[model samples]
Target chain A: MKVRVTVMLKEGVLDPQGKAIGHALHTLGFPGVEAVRVGKIIDLDLKSTDAQAARAEAEKMASELLANLVIEDFTVEVLG
Target chain B: MKVRVTVMLKEGVLDPQGKAIGHALHTLGFPGVEAVRVGKIIDLDLKSTDAQAARAEAEKMASELLANLVIEDFTVEVLG
Candidate 1:
């Protein structure tokens, strides 16, 4: 099974990289863009054939090693 | 308008980060995981109200600034 993990900074946390991206967009003549938030995606191919098992295992990887649960939120999408 | 851009490295490209993450996961006793590919997500809040216009604008930002056309492929997902 293939699992896709998307992680983003939690709300209320300031993202300096996002602010820089917004500034860069404006400088590049795309002033219509208001804000930008950058996040991460991790795609994993699991050995398990079960969808539920793969998602549960991927979620474990995400929470333990893939994402910072303190300030980042992650969603595991099973793309089997 | 809200637009999401998911960027991933082109196929066959080396992913050291992904490999490192995979190693860490196995080290943490998750040997069931096979392979991992790491990508990026860029969320943009545009001033435009039109979904089509927002997607077009977000695509431009992605190709011009958010993604490198040489080694990365990006998809724009427009969310109202």
Candidate 2:
């Protein structure tokens, strides 16, 4: 099974990198961009065949190593 | 409008970060993880209201600045 884990900073947490990207975009003539938030997309190729099991395993991976629980939230999706 | 741009390295490109993450996962007991690829997910808050126009603008941003055409491929999605 294939799993995708998207890890994003929690709302209210400051994202300096995102701000920098937004600033760069504005400098490059994209004035309509109001805000930007950047996150990580991790795709995992798992040996599991079951979607349910894959999702569970991916969630574990996200919580354990992919995301910081204090400032980040992650969503795990199984693409079997 | 809300736009999501997912930028991923082109196939066959070296991804040391992803490999490191995979190795770390393996070390941390995720033996079922066969492979890992990492990408970026960028969320943009745009002033545009039209979904069609937002998609076009986001695609333009991805091509112009968000992704390296020589090494990365990006997908743009507008969330109206």
Candidate 3:
């Protein structure tokens, strides 16, 4: 099975790296590029046979090591 | 308009950051987590009224500012 996890900073969280990227875009003449929020995408290949178990395991992975739950939120997508 | 740009390390490229994260996952007891490849997702709000133009512009943004073309690839998705 394949899974994709996206981890993003929650709203109202300060993202200095994202701000830097947004500034870079403006300097590169990308007009109307108001803001840029940068997040993470984690692609995984798992051997689990059950889809629900895989998702639950992946969610546990996300909460445990993949994301900073205090300031970030994550979503998981399972793919065949 | 809302757009999402995902930038990922190209195949065969060495991703030390991703490897470190994978190791961390293993140490945290995430069994069967074979590998973890980390990428970036950029969310943007644009003022463009045309969908095609917005996608093209966002692609340009990804190429010019969001992704390192030498070792990375990017995809753009437009959302209402």
Candidate 4:
């Protein structure tokens, strides 16, 4: 089984890196690029036999290790 | 207009952050998690009247700032 976890900073959080990228885009003549928010995607290769079990475990992984619940949120997608 | 850019490390590139996350998952008892790869997503808010032009400009932004073409690849998705 395979899983993809997407972790994003919560709304209202300031993203310095994203802001820097937006500024670079503006300087490069990409007009009207008002804002940019950056997030992370984690692709996982797993050897689980049960899809349901794998999803459960992956969610646990997100909460425990893959994401920081204080300032971020995450979603998990399973792919066979 | 809005654009989403996804940047990923090329295959065969070493990702220490991803490896660290994988180790954490393993320690948390996520069995069968063989590998993890990390990528980035950048969400953009643009004020373009033309979607086609917005996409083209966003691609250039990805090439010049959002991604390192030497070791990374990127894709852009436009949203109205």
Candidate 5:
């Protein structure tokens, strides 16, 4: 099974890296680029075949080690 | 308009960051986790309304500024 976990900084969280990227985009002449929020996409390959079981396990993985729950939020997607 | 650019390390490219994350997950007791590849998701809010144009512009942004073309590949997705 394949799973994707998207980890993003929650709203109101300061993201220096994203700011830097946004500045870079502006410098590169991308006009009208309002905001750029950068996040992580973690693609996981698991041995399990069950989608529900894999999603549950991946969600645990996200909460346990993949995300900083205090300032970040994560969503899990199970893909075949 | 909203656009998302997904940047990923090219195959055969060494990703120490991803390896470290995988190791961390293993230590945290995710036994079925086979592999983990980490990438970036750049969310952009643009002023344009044309989805096609926005996607093209975002693709250009990804290639020129957001992704390292030598070692990274990017895909652009336009969201309503």
Candidate 6:
């Protein structure tokens, strides 16, 4: 199975990297951009074939190591 | 309008960060993981109302600034 985990900073947290990217975009002539937020996408290839079990395992991985609970939130999705 | 740009290292490229993550997961007891790839997800809030225009703008941004074309590939998705 293939699984994906997305980890993002919680709202109300400042994201300097995102701010810098938005600024760079404006400098590069993309004036239509209003805001930007950056996050992590982890794609996993798992030996398990069951989608439900894979999702649960991915979620556990996120909670235990992939995310900082105080500042970040994560979501797990199972893909074929 | 909102747009998401996902940037990933091209296949065959070395990804030390991803390797480190996979090693850590293995040490943490996720023995079922076969491989892992890390990428970026950039969420953009655009002032434009037209989805088509927004997607085009985002693609331009991704090509010019968000992705390192020599090593990274990117995909742009427009969302409401």
lDDT of 2 by residue, A1-80 (tens): 98999999999999999999999999999999999999999999999999999999999999989999999999998777
Per-residue CA lDDT of model 3 for A12-78, tens digit only, reads 9998888887788778788777777889999877778778888888898988878899999999999
- Per-residue C-alpha lDDT of model 5 across residues B4-76, encoded as one tens digit per residue: 9999999999988888888888887887888889899999999889999999899889888889999999999
lDDT of 4: 0.88
Instruction: Provide DockQ values for all models, in the order shown.
Output: 0.94, 0.95, 0.81, 0.85, 0.90, 0.95
Per-model interface RMSD values are 0.6, 0.4, 1.1, 1.0, 0.7, 0.5
lDDT of each: 0.94, 0.95, 0.87, 0.88, 0.91, 0.94
Per-residue CA lDDT of model 4 for B2-71, tens digit only, reads 8889999999999998899889888878768999999999999988868898898789888988899999
The prediction achieving the highest DockQ against the true structure is 2
**What's the TM-score of each model vs. the native?**
0.98, 0.98, 0.94, 0.91, 0.96, 0.98
Scored against the true structure, residue B16 in model 4 reaches a CA lDDT of 98
- Per-residue CA lDDT of model 3 for B1-80, tens digit only, reads 78999999999999888788778887878768777788999998777878898899999888877889999999999986
| C-alpha root-mean-square deviation, each candidate | 0.6, 0.6, 1.2, 1.6, 1.0, 0.7
Q: Pick out the ten consecutive residues of candidate 2 chain B with the lowest summed lDDT.
A: B71-80
> Pairs clashing in candidate 2?
none
Model 4 chain A poorest ten-residue lDDT run: A23-32
lDDT of 5 by residue, A1-79 (tens): 9999999999999988888888888888987788888899999999899999999999998898889999999999988
Scanning candidate 3 chain A in windows of ten residues, the lowest lDDT window is A27-36
Better of 4 and 5 by lDDT: 5
Ranking by DockQ: 2, 6, 1, 5, 4, 3
> What does DockQ come to for candidate 6?
0.95
